[model samples]
Structure formats: C-alpha cells, structure tokens
Target chain A: MKILSTLILLVALALGSAQAQKFITKSGNIRFFSSTPIEDILAHNRQVNSALDQQTGDFVFRVLMKSFQFEKALMQEHFNENYVESDKFPNATFTGKVTNIKDIDFAKNGVYNAIVEGDLTIKGVTKKISEKGTFEVKDGKVIGKSTFNVLVEDYGIKIPGAVAKNIAKSIQIDVDVNLEKLE
Target chain B: MKKKWLIIIGGLAAAGIVLALLVYFFVYNKPHKDYSKAKPDFEVEAIAFFEEFRTNAAASSARYNGKVIAITGQLSSVEVTDEQVVALFEIDEGMFGSEGVRCVLIPEKAETLISIPPGSTITIKGHCTGYNETDVILEHCSIAI
Candidate 1:
C-alpha cells in the first residue's frame, strides 16, 4: 500500500514538471560535411526550429534544403540538383527524446551531457540514431548540442565513383540548439 | 654582361605580369554577385512565415520568382557557391505551427551577411522564387542590418 501511494505521488510530480517546461526555440542549427579526396564540401542550415517537451523528452527539429548555400555556383547547382534534390526533398528533421529524464534538473545551472535517441530523417530517408549531446540549464533557458555522422547511401544518396572516392561514405553532422522556458 | 642582365630583368617582369593576370582571372574575374542589397517587401517573424510558405510552395513557385521578401530568424545555414550565394534561415522546433518554413536567399544579397553565428537573430531581404517544400526562394537578397 505504501509503495502504491509513493508511485502515485511520483507520477503526479512528473506530470507537473512537464507542464512547467513549455518553452521552445524558433531557431537552431544543423550542419553536414562530406569530404572526398577530389572535393571537400561543407553545408549548413541555420534556420531550424524545434520544441522540447520536458515531461515526455519529445523534440522536433526542421530545416529547408534549398536554404543550404555553397561557394561555387556550379557546386550550388549540383548540390540542389544532383546531390540533395532540393526540389524533391525540401526539408530535414529530427524527432526523438532524452532517455534519462530524471538526470536533468532544469532549475539548476551547469552543463550536463545527455544521451538523446531519436529518428533523423533527411532526403526522404529515416534512420534511428542515438546521439550524445550536451544540455545546459541556465536562468530558465536550455541549450542542447551534439555531433554525429550519417551515410549518404543509407538515405539513398548515390555518388558516381569518379568523385565517390573523394566523398566519404559517411558525412559528419553537427547540431547546436537553444530553447527558452515557456510559461 | 650588361645586356644579358637587362634581358633577364625584362623576362622576370613579363612573368610577373602574366602571374598577376592569371590570379585576377582565377580569383576576382568570376561572378561576384552579392544579393544582400535587394530591398525587402515585408518583415515577418520566422516561424509564422515558414508555415505559410511551406503550405503553398508548389502552388507559389512561379509567382515567387524574382520577388523580394523580408524574413527574421536565426541563421541556420550558409553556403557560398560560385554561381550564386545561398543561405538558409530557419525557425521552428516542430514540423507544425510556425516552425517549418525557411528563406533561401541567393546571389548578391548574401554579401550583407557579414557574419551569422548560431543562435543569433537576423533579418534578411530577397526576392521570392517560388518554393521547394518548406523553403521560400529569394533572389538578389541582402541583409537588413
């Protein structure tokens, strides 16, 4: 009987804490880098928006592909037309949750590393990924950051061998995000 | 000996001239459009604008061509290309509501983007060139500092 009462109290507290975390950020960053011996390409998209459900550890991030710019006009054309098919797949996304919710204390200040497992979708392909990311809580604001790699082929991005050797099979991705506490 | 020295100097000068010309062609002669100068037609919050644009990219692509529009948001991505400069400005944490749309600015307008750090607010002006899903295309855009 005592254990049941304690469980009820814990569930109530969790629900209350989640209700308190209604904040989100309108802008975030997602970057991709593909380096090959023949050419090294780096592209990033800054205009990302995401929301974090503190109670459920649910998050969603998005960006447009056409927004990615390259230095050479030829390269930009190729990126949109050939590589990313910007016209076909205009947006990329990440939807997931933080596994260890009990470890995060949003009211406190300091940096804590959390493992966030989520599904990242790009170019019409989705993959399950677990990322080790940094989370910071300061003055009611939370910031999250992580870096990982994804294979182009996994998403069905095909590169001809002529330049394929130059482009690594897997691309490195970096993410930096910040969110404000909502009332 | 004096004649030979003069000839050598002449050759060196000619080589220097050729090198300078080559550098100019390779470095500075190409297209240098910086679209960050096109005036903005409107100013809208990033999230709300993205939602509206994404809802109608397929229908509006033709109408948006070469149209200038203004957007404010965090700088999400920057890509420098020889044919054109492109930047992706985004805002949204969810796929719904006001968080899915982005402004893709190209060409000369990119020049005004002096520096964009992650998590900073920026307002940009450029022409709309239709839509690819959630991206609102802008041509000849410039930043409104």
Candidate 2:
C-alpha cells in the first residue's frame, strides 16, 4: 500500500509541474514614433525585459530609463536629461494580467486575443490601463503584440509652446515580444 | 548718456550668452571626479564605480566617455545601451583573486556572456575604460568561461 501511495504522489507532482511552464523575454522590443509634415522622429529601446506567469496570468516588464535610443546623440541626451530625467526616475515598469489563460493553450499553434490590464509606470507616474493583444503560440514559442497611446501632458511632461505643436501630445507605443517557454 | 547705458546693457547680455555657452560645453563637459584622470589598471567594485559615475553625470546620465572596471554581485543584470552593453554582476564570497573587486562588463562582444544567472560563481574578462553613473564600463568584455 505504501508503494502504491508513493507512486500516486509522484504522478501528481509530475502533472503539476507540467502544467506550470512559464515564458519570458527580457529583450523584447518597444518603439515610439512621432511625425509631422516637416520631420519624422523615432525612438526605441530593445532592452525591454518582460516575464509572464503561466499559472496565475501575471506579467511584468522593465526597461532602463536611459536605454531608449534615438537617432542622434544630442537627441538621446536631451531625451534623458532634459526630458526623461533618467537618473531621477531610473526605470519604467508594467505589472498586468493576461486575462483568459484557460482559453489559450500553449501546446497548440494558433492566434489568441487576450485582454491585458495593468499599471504602467512611466516618468515617475503610474496609470492604470486596459489594452488588448494578440498572442500566437507556435513551435514552443509565444509571440505577443499590442499598440496603445499615451498622452504626455497626462504624465506632466511639459513642452515649450515654440515646439509644442511639433510634438504630438499623444504618443503611440508598439510592443512586439517573442518569448520562450522556461523549462 | 542714454546711448552709453544701452551699450553697457548690450555688452552685459553678450557676456551672459558667452558664459552660458562656456558652462554648457566646457564646464558641464567636465564631470565630477573625472575618472579618465584615474591611472590605468586601477580596480574597484561595481557599486563604488556606479556611485561615482552617477555623481559625475548629474546633469545628464549618458554613456561613459572613458574606461572603467567593476565587480557586481549578479551576472544577469548586465545590459547594453548606446552601442555599449555595460555588464552588471554581483560578487559572491566564493569569488577569489580579485578580492571583492566586482566587475561591470561593457559592450564589445557582450554576446558571448549570455545565460549567466544571478549569484552564480564565474569570472569576467574585459578592458576597463570609464564610469557611467550606473555602470563601471568595461569597453570590450567577454566571459572568461
């Protein structure tokens, strides 16, 4: 009887472990673009790291405030010191949940639309936002993507009137992430 | 008399502009402690190096303009930005030889140093260049293993 009980316990443990495979990617890419008729500006930070908890549907992302790269060094410097103040506010983080984990299966290959809600902290300010994303699972890999808009004034970023119209008050963000399941 | 006063005011304004220009380019150009002034082959821990770098780049936390060396406690924290992937690692008690002189790996072949976990025992190899407020830069760093 003891041997049978031990065998049953081992099987349960194996099943539990198999159900808890999580996926994460720290080198995720996030980009922001703003353009006008006269000029077009682009910025991106590839160091955006993120993790997804498969068991609980929790997710987290982090990026160094100084990591956002621009086309020119002068523009990079201005973005950090003058605009982002990277030193004072070192990182931007997002903590959210990918709703409907049960509806999605990692073993199968298909596109699944998920609702994500979380607190996005940027420029030392935290805002609650709800966004939708399409996640594709194929060949033991998961790819997630989302596009959203954030208003600068809502985050207390001030632009001088001389160049205010040049920069859009609302900035659009695109996130494309590729994650590998952690064994 | 009015013309003379106007001339004096204009001269003062010109001087102010020149002063602002000088401070921005030259004076602000010089960071605090100026580790580039440090002698070659000097070694220090990662935390100490980041502290100095942060103080120097008070106006702007940008990339290192010179060489640096550091020892961190973890390897996973190493990252690259601005054509430089500054390595960040933690020093463990078992790590010997450097004697607590933890290291930060800057870009220059950072690709080889992948899959390093935190609190793991390992050795790092790199050229010490300069300090940024957050990292003690190793210009060209690779994993010793």
lDDT by residue for model 2 (A22-88), tens: 6776457888877666556678866566777767788778766655656655555666676666657
Candidate 2 structure quality by residue, lDDT tens digits, B1-145: 9999999999999999999999877643443332223343434445554555555644323343223332333454554443345445532222111112223343434565545655565545544433222233343344554
- Model 1 stretches with alpha carbons more than 4 Å out: A1-20, B1-33, B37-58, B61-124, B127-145
Model 1 chain A: ten consecutive residues of lowest lDDT:
A66-75
lDDT of 1 by residue, B96-131 (tens): 333333444444445656366656788777655445
Q: Which portions of model 2 show Cα errors greater than 4 Å?
A: A1-19, B1-145
Question: What root-mean-square deviation over C-alphas does model 2 reach?
Answer: 8.7
> On residues A87-146, what C-alpha lDDT tens digit does candidate 1 reach at each position?
666667788888886688877998988888899888889999898988898888888888
State the TM-score of the second chain for every model. Answer: 0.53, 0.37
Report, for every candidate in turn, its global Cα lDDT versus the true structure: 0.67, 0.62
Q: How high is each candidate's TM-score?
A: 0.62, 0.62
